[model samples]
Target: MKRSYFSAPYAVWMVVFTIFPIVFVGLYAITTRRADGNDLYTGLANIGNIFGNEGTYMKVLWRSLSLALQCTAICLLLGYPCAYFLASKDFAKHKTLYVLILLPMWMNFLLRTYASMGLLERNGVINSIVTALGFKRLELIGTQGAVLYGMVYNYLPFMILPIHTVLKKMDQRVIEAAQDLGANPVRVFYKVTLPLSIPGIISGITMVFMPSVTTFAISGLLGSGNFMLIGDVIETQFMSANNWNFGSALSLFMTVLILISIGLLNRMDKSKTGNGGGKW
Candidate 1:
């Protein structure tokens, strides 16, 4: 059969939008301003500057990784059960529930984060409720906990939706056969359901982890300028510090980190499913 040319436009779009931007960033990262006000190829000079400032930058990188890990863990813990329930026969019959699960995502993410900001602020709704009950007002905002909460809240759906998709599409007979073979519900889940869901879980982890690590808006709004993440630093380097080269270098480092993470996750997925096909 002759292949259709329908993918040609999308290939062009990918080159223009994705490939071009990456190449541009790479160029910016490697080029530096010379003494005569002209640009010169620095080779690894910009990367060297990143290493020189490794003290602060590494600290920020660690914090970003830690928070992103926390957020991803929380999302998996919370989303897995929710997804399993929603994918069950009972809830699958009620499609409206799925719509409701995705309703918050339909709204603007910035708006949702801003609304979360209000709820977590010093004198926000929670504080008001606490004071109403004669308890001390809680200072939730501008803390690492608050940032972590914002990360989970924003990215939880990313974790849930993929897992639900996998579970809903899973073959029922595999689970039934396991049960028929004297497997209890828990054993069936561990041996059959959980193993089969590895692909979805890995995908969900990628979705949650990447955004959580790279996000600046949630940290900025919730942390109230108190916290400084790598994303915030990159933004400051470009916007406030007027250091595009450094920003580009940092962006390159971040991209490499994300790629490494994705590679590791893919390796784990391949080990679980064997042959890298993710098929049972």
Candidate 2:
């Protein structure tokens, strides 16, 4: 069979939109500021600066990673049961509930973050209700808690969807077989369901963690720019400081970090699957 001309268009689009832009940014990162204020060739200087001034940037990276981890943990802890519930139930009865779970995702991300901010602020709805009930208004805005909440709220669906997909596809007979073998519910879950659903868990975790790590808008809105995340650092470097080279270098470093983490995750997943010998 011969390939169609449509494939050529897609290839051209990929080169123009993705490949060229990536190559351009990488090239830009290695360039220096000339005396005439133009970006000139200066090999490795920008990358060097990234390592040299590692204090703030490294802190931001750590903060972003920490937040991403926290979000992933919380999502898995909370979402797993919900996903299991949805998966186990009849499709007709659970349809509305599933829709409710997904409804929030349809809203704009920025709007959702701002809504969280409004509710979390001192004089916002939550605080007003608390004060009306003769209680003190807790300060939730501009704190790590708020950032964590925003992250969870935004990415919870990403965690739930993949897990639900896997759980729904699970064969009920396998679970019954475990029970027939004298395994308790918890034991069956740990030894069978959990291992079987790992691919979905991995996908969900990656989906939530990657974007959460690089989220600047949520941090700015919920944390009120008080927190310094890696994403915010990149934005500040490029937009505010007008340091393209440094910003690109930071971005490159973040990309590399994400790739490393994902690689490790994939290896662990493969090891688990290999050890299990597909029994799970």
Candidate 3:
């Protein structure tokens, strides 16, 4: 009973910060005001505008999803091997390496991203190196590639850390038992390690994908305002266009989309494990 009391403050915080905002946004999204200044609920009108014949929102959504997926994929491909090495017994003596890996995260994320801008800009560090090496200077900033690069750079640690935690906590006995059964490294990994690591991979994917999808800073700074993402649109709607109702509508839609994606990922994880996932 005392433990229940401990949760009261947290519950109150969630109600105030989370639930209230969602409820307010929903109210704004579904209701319209008449000439008499009375609000009327209009079902799906805002949604239809988002997905109707205009197709502008649809394109923005697709672009966001595509970039998010690409960033997630890149993170996974890079993070897995790095995590594997860090989690290996051979490197157990070097705990400092893990701290070094995490050192970048201690710095402000925006500052780190902004620092990358300096390195990537034309005639910056990279371009200067290329020029000195008798190579053509490459245009690095204000391109889709630059935006994608920023996403990968900023979010890669999110992918690595979770998987590293999971891997470090994994039971070594299972791995040894698999080895005792004469299973080769490749076979054991595919048959056991990889399957067992699905939870971490799912966590990593969620961490990387969500922010990548909704990020405005990376795209705005690196993309030079050429690309328009759903986040950018939402910001513009509220800030520039003064369309609070539409912005609320967009936020509600994005919340739904994110929930759906998380639901699907959870379902997939559950199907693989047959019980959501086993406790560590």
Among the numbered candidates, top lDDT falls to 1
Query: Model 2, 142-249: lDDT tens per residue?
Result: 999899999999999899888888888888899999999999999999999999888788888889999999989889999998997988988998899888888888
Q: In candidate 1, residue 29 scores what lDDT? A: 95
Query: For residues 203-259, could you state the per-residue lDDT of candidate 3 as single tens digits?
Result: 899999999999897888888888888999999988998666778898899988999
Q: Of the candidates shown, which would achieve the greatest TM-score relative to the real structure? A: 1
| TM-score, one value per model | 0.94, 0.93, 0.93
Worst 10 residues of 1 by lDDT: 271-280
Cα lDDT of model 3 overall? 0.87
- Judge candidate 1 at residue 51 and give its lDDT: 64
RMSD of each: 2.0, 2.6, 2.0
- Model 1 lDDT per residue over 1-280, tens place: 7667878999999999999999988998999867687878888788777767648888888899999999999999999999899889966454787787789999988899899988988789888899999998898999988889888989999999888888888899999999899999999999999998988899999999999999898889998878889999999999998878889989999999999999999999989887532321
In model 2, the worst 10-residue window by lDDT is: 271-280
The residue ranges of model 1 lying beyond 4 angstroms of the native Cα positions read 92-94, 275-280
Model 2 accuracy (lDDT, Cα): 0.86
| Deviation in Å, model 3, residue 219 alpha carbon | 0.4
Against the reference, the lDDT scores of all candidates come to: 0.89, 0.86, 0.87
